[model samples]
Target: MKTLISGGTVVSLDPSIGDLARGDVLVDNGLITEVAAHIDAPDAEVIDACDRIVMPGFVDNHRHAWQTAFRGIGSDWTFPQWAAAMHGTVKAHYTPEDVYIGTLLGRLEALHSGVTTMLDWYHVAQTHEHEDAAIDALTDAPGRSVFCLGAGWGGGDSVDDDIRRVRARLSGGGRIDLALGMRGPGATGIDTAAREVKLADELGLRISLHIEAPGVITALHEHGLLRDTLTGVHANGIGEDELRLLADAGGSLSISPDVELKMGFGAPMTGVALAAGLRPTLSIDDVPSVGGDMFSTMRTAFAAQRGIDGGLRSRDLLDFATVDAAASMGLRDRTGSLTPGKDADIVLLRTDDVTIFPVTDPAASIVSHGHPGLVDTVLAAGRVVKRDGALVGVDLPALRTRLLASRDRIAEAAGVPLDGTWRPQP
Candidate 1:
């Protein structure tokens, strides 16, 4: 089947080239068939893209799918408190059913917000049943995802068994990509982290590690573990030397700016990383803590950079959430750019929206004033997952209700009330 998205202002987002104006795109069997002006296909279903800005769908590089059920769990807590409460709650009350519902809800939000792809850092899979439940939920969602399979939360010495079990059950099939989530400095010591990273390498799987605390990248560099397939998540404290090592190794970095600022990890993100040849991406770290809004992520990262460094261009911020982010997830070829032969993972923004009105510049308006409501349509792999800012193929109301009940239960099990607050004593 062929689909034509014609007469839209296309932002190609191709790193090799730049945005295009008054463009048309064609999709055939889920891949972008062609991208240009005045393309003609006789047998194609056409979508009117007039007055819309068609660009690559946002790619969220880091999110906890399990936290979808806990959208407002620690809204009023400090970083430490939030961490403690999240750990306590998830450990006690998150069942496999909860995992399924949460992941489905999270992916639904992604589709609704024009995020065609998400790298779900799901570390709450405590059993085979739990793993299957999460996978089932992702498959149910219309959008694509990278399930970064992980062991139970916190430090562990012997994860090889868990890794093998998850791989045996989940991998060797191409539907959902699997990356091992190597616990970062906050969760594990240097030695344990090295073991997890090496294990991922031995298995020939992509690896993602959190770099919350100091010297995490240095530790990885010392062990020669940084590589093309390794993605460092939330490298808020990484320095120039460490970033150089990351770029040299051909690895990638993802920054969850809102989460970082909320947790007081750092001000702004790794512009230094970009300067040193590493273009850091953006993400919604958790849904409950912060809603799943990639535009918000882009804006926060953009403002933080300019606030810290005096000024930053709008194009750079857009890249952080689009092509650069896709590259960080190793999905640049498939979904980042509005290029021919790529997946039709596209988003259409209404330039005439209130916040976006009087658009001085198209890209500038997107960075400064873009929001989810302005996303008129969203397509993932040529499939219309959302249109008019509402999700399709899923009952969002039911999902929201189910998740709210689960959150209350989780909080009750954690010995806390349903009110949104948390903080660990430092």
Candidate 2:
């Protein structure tokens, strides 16, 4: 099927031509066929894009998809305390049903906010049933995702069982891509990291690591596990040398500014990573604390970068949410920019929104004034997932109730009341 987007300000994101005003976009067979001033497709469905900011759909590079059920369950907790409570609960209490509800909520949220593609950094597979439940949730959603499958933090029989499930999922050849999600050197050492990376390489899959500190990469490199297949998350502590090694080794980094700030992980060096020949992208990290909106990540990243280095232009942050973000997800060839022959993952921003009224600059408007509510339309793989800021084909209220019930069960198992916070009194 072919569709033509008529007469809108297209942020083509194509470096060759850049942004165009009063442009036309054409989509055929789930890919952008053309993006020019005036296109003629006689048999295609035409849609008006008047006063819309048509750009590439946002890509959230790193996400804990199962955390959606506990969105507001970790408030007022420090990083250590929050992880102990929230992460521990997932390992001990989350059932297969919990995985299903949590992932569904998270995926639907991404669709609503114009995030067409996501990296589901799933690390809570306690049983084969749990793995099945997580995949079921993603399969039900409209957005695309890479399932970074892993065992629950229990780390013994759980890891072995999760690996078997991962193998089965890969063998099935479904929409889910199999990637290794490790707990890093702190939780698992260099030997374990190498084993996981090797498994991914053998299967031609990419591996994502949580680089909470510089030591994680150092340990991986020391053990000869750092390579193109490895991508680091929260690369805030790495210095110049470590950054170069990552760039040289063809590894990518995802800087989730909001989670980094809230957890006191220190300032993100996204600029420095880019300067060192790495276009380190950004992500929302997890829902609830950071919210599942890439716009929030873009805003926080831009403000943090500028606040640290004194100031920056607006286009700087847009790249983090679009092209740079796609690079982080290893999807530079599939989506990211509204380039011809790429997936038609597009986001139409309602520039006429009151919050962004008196718009000064288009790029600046996105970073400083834009929010999820301003996302007017979203298209993923040539299908309209959201129109006029409403999710299609999903009962959001019912999903929310399921998620809350799952949260209550988890809180009961953890022997704590999840009113609003996960921090237990010391």
TM per candidate comes to 0.94, 0.94
The true-structure Cα RMSD of candidate 2 reads 2.0
Model 1 vs. true fold: TM = 0.94
lDDT of 1 by residue, 7-123 (tens): 888888875445667878899998987888778987999888887898899888788888887676655555676666666555557788888888888888887888888888887
- On residues 148-167, what C-alpha lDDT tens digit does candidate 2 reach at each position? 87655525222434655566
Tell me the lDDT of model 2 at 184. Answer: 71
How many clashes does each candidate structure show, in the order listed? 4, 0
Q: Which pairs of residues have clashing backbones in candidate 2?
A: none
Whole-model lDDT values for every prediction: 0.79, 0.79
**Candidate 2: which stretches are off by over 4 Å?**
154-161, 170-174
